[model samples]
Target: MEQQNWSLATYCVAPHVAGTATLQGARLTDFGGLSVPIHTSSTYKVDSAEQGAVLASRKGWPELRKDGSTAKDEFFYSRWRNPTVAAVAAHLAALERAEGCLLFGTGMAAISTSVLSAVKAGDHIISQSSVYGGTFHLFSHYLRESFAVQVTFVNIEDLNTLERYIRPNTKVIYVESPSNPTLRLVNLEHIASIGKKHNILTIIDSTLATPINQQPLTLGIDVVVHSATKFLSGHSDLTAGAVLSNSQDFLKQVLFLQQTLGSTLSPFDAFLLARGLKTLHLRVSHQNNAALKIAHFLDTHPKVKVVHYPGLSSHKDFHLAQRQMSNGCGGLLSFELLGGREDGRKVIEHLQVINLAVSLGSVESLVEQAATMTHSQLNKEDLSEAGIDESLIRLSVGIENVDDLIEDLRQALEYV
Candidate 1:
């Protein structure tokens, strides 16, 4: 198969148009087609046994200090790297304006590997009180028990708690902007500044606000991670993750740790991720617009208690979100049903257009009760501490027409 003669950056494609540029990479003439042919081969061939040994050795052990890669660092086996996976990473890096990017088999893989690569046993980590349930489990349960690492979760707005808790051994400050379920945003510039002042690495899981809506790296964060299965994939079909960094050193650590952990993203899933990136800008734009309309609708409804969307003027961090993400608030928002848990369930049962399921950034809308669904791992005390109410229903707006979505919600609210 012949590859595309025009590379991602071979022409007039601008950085602002990286989403479109990434799809162009898939149009490989080398494959004798326009779609990115999945390179599903588990292993690649070498010229000779001697060449194979050298290539295997290089692939087995990474040059952790190397910045730019050469053909020598090419894929030897699917475990270490894959051509299709690399293409997705390349596109993601371009999308985030990062020096490099690495893909993982799952979002947890990306988060866990990046954390392990940056910190060591006995080192401490400071993270926001609210984060994805999986992330919370890893930091509070797995990382603590397996590595003897210390973990402190503080409200993102509680700078005093964050500062007071920071210890000499604290090595990383991890945060999730527009945090899961809550949609509560952290001041990225503030947190990044704090990390720089303390000489600590800052890692942000910007899964809720995809690069199309927000780019934390530009706000001075050290590294950016994503659960690409969400908005990055657009459609809800694939599960994957990505790590992007401007620091070559940081990327090297993550890439090495990823291979060591054996959590590489599969080439097949990577191909799906690449196809998703093509319409990322388009999908997110529609999502953003629809989300604003939906949020406004929820706010004015008598059955709703409070709406947590940055687009709403009433949201506490509306200005902060405005400053950081001008494109729009993301496609997600959470609201409190007036009658609490029963009302939440009633609304879910009545919903026709919005799915009563988990996961976001998909073309189909999804609504889930945070306490029982996504954040079920958290105990009552932990949930209360994180300010997650039992009645909270997190809504992920899809590309569906805004009027139909609003109508669906209107009918659903009658049940509440």
Candidate 2:
């Protein structure tokens, strides 16, 4: 019952494996290797013009073939695909429990490309106000100015008001769960149901939650997107983004856009991403627990006005979070300090173990005031509309000891 000659990768990434085995990547040769081998060649070799011709036409995820050679696309160029990049995408696909996934150079690249693919010149997109600032800018500014595509930003909690914003031409509904900086929750089920009823696509930015925390696709979302630079690459050493989907047609379209845009991920970074995946479970689990403890600590502090963490019983969305995220709240939380922006800066500047910085989901905690940093220039009114306040201090809980984290915060808050 011996099979014919097969590529080293196919045999190793066989279905039976899960978790770290999948993260370690497919074997490089007949004899399995423990570490994922990086493929740096920008252009792969081809045996014939016919083979080159076949590879040149490939723009989508290659099929898994068993005849040893049927699935091989080891020709043409890396811009279309690379074994290294493909391996990490496969690993993510397995983790997200999706039919397929794509990797891009940065989170914004993935978001932009997907946005381009999902809408046409005249299509309308409905999005929530509470999202990453970059995403908000993309939908509210660039897409509208260049494509003449209409965009609407609404409060997700007011379903009636949100539904009123939807139009007959609405092609998509984009959501960001555990919203950027604020850590607000959007009910995925409600959005998905609206999308289904209206025959629109539902796209969820689940970066903050990570695959360990929640699975949007399972909740009837058409696609799940992530800024893999965060928790997915726990060390924060690499920058990458991912798109996952169950629809072959949508994936194919997005793949075409991905190639045309040419925001391809380099093989070396792809290798780094693969390495990151190996410890994803370990890192996220520890951080998740740490975040809850930190959130609890923030809750009782007299100087803290409000703490935003779904894991906390005081949170407005605790029941919804309990329903969606089975793991834990996640490694992110936000709190407001007593004295507004000045006091927020005092807390951020006073941190020791927690670095005062923008960007998050690293092994070392980061604290930042979103009003001056992440969220674009906006008045108090605009900030309130997005569920973010001038005094909100966003904290990315790291995997550091909970006691140490609490002690660091204690000294930091004394400044307030």
* Residue 280 C-alpha lDDT in model 2: 78
lDDT for model 1 comes to 0.83
- Model 1, span 332-371: residue lDDT tens: 9999987998899899889998889899989999999999
Relative to the unseen true structure, what is the C-alpha lDDT of residue 51 in candidate 1, on a scale of 0 to 100? 72
What lDDT score is found at residue 142 in candidate 1?
89
> Which regions of candidate 1 deviate over 4 angstroms?
1-15, 22-32, 48-50, 59-73
Pairs that collide in candidate 1 are 1-30, 2-29, 2-30, 3-29, 3-30, 4-29
- What is the per-residue lDDT of model 2 for residues 1-416, given as tens digits with 9 covering 90 to 100? 99666443344345534445345554443455665567788887787887777667673346522112224555367887777777677777767767778899999998888888989999999888888989987887789998899988887577445678789899989989888877778888888898998899999899999887888888999989899888888787889999889887888788888889898888788878877777877788888899999898999999999999989998988998999997887999999977898999888988988988888888888888999998865556768988897999999988788899999999988987
Provide the lowest-lDDT 10-residue window in model 2: 63-72
Model 1, residue 81: C-alpha shift (Å) = 1.4
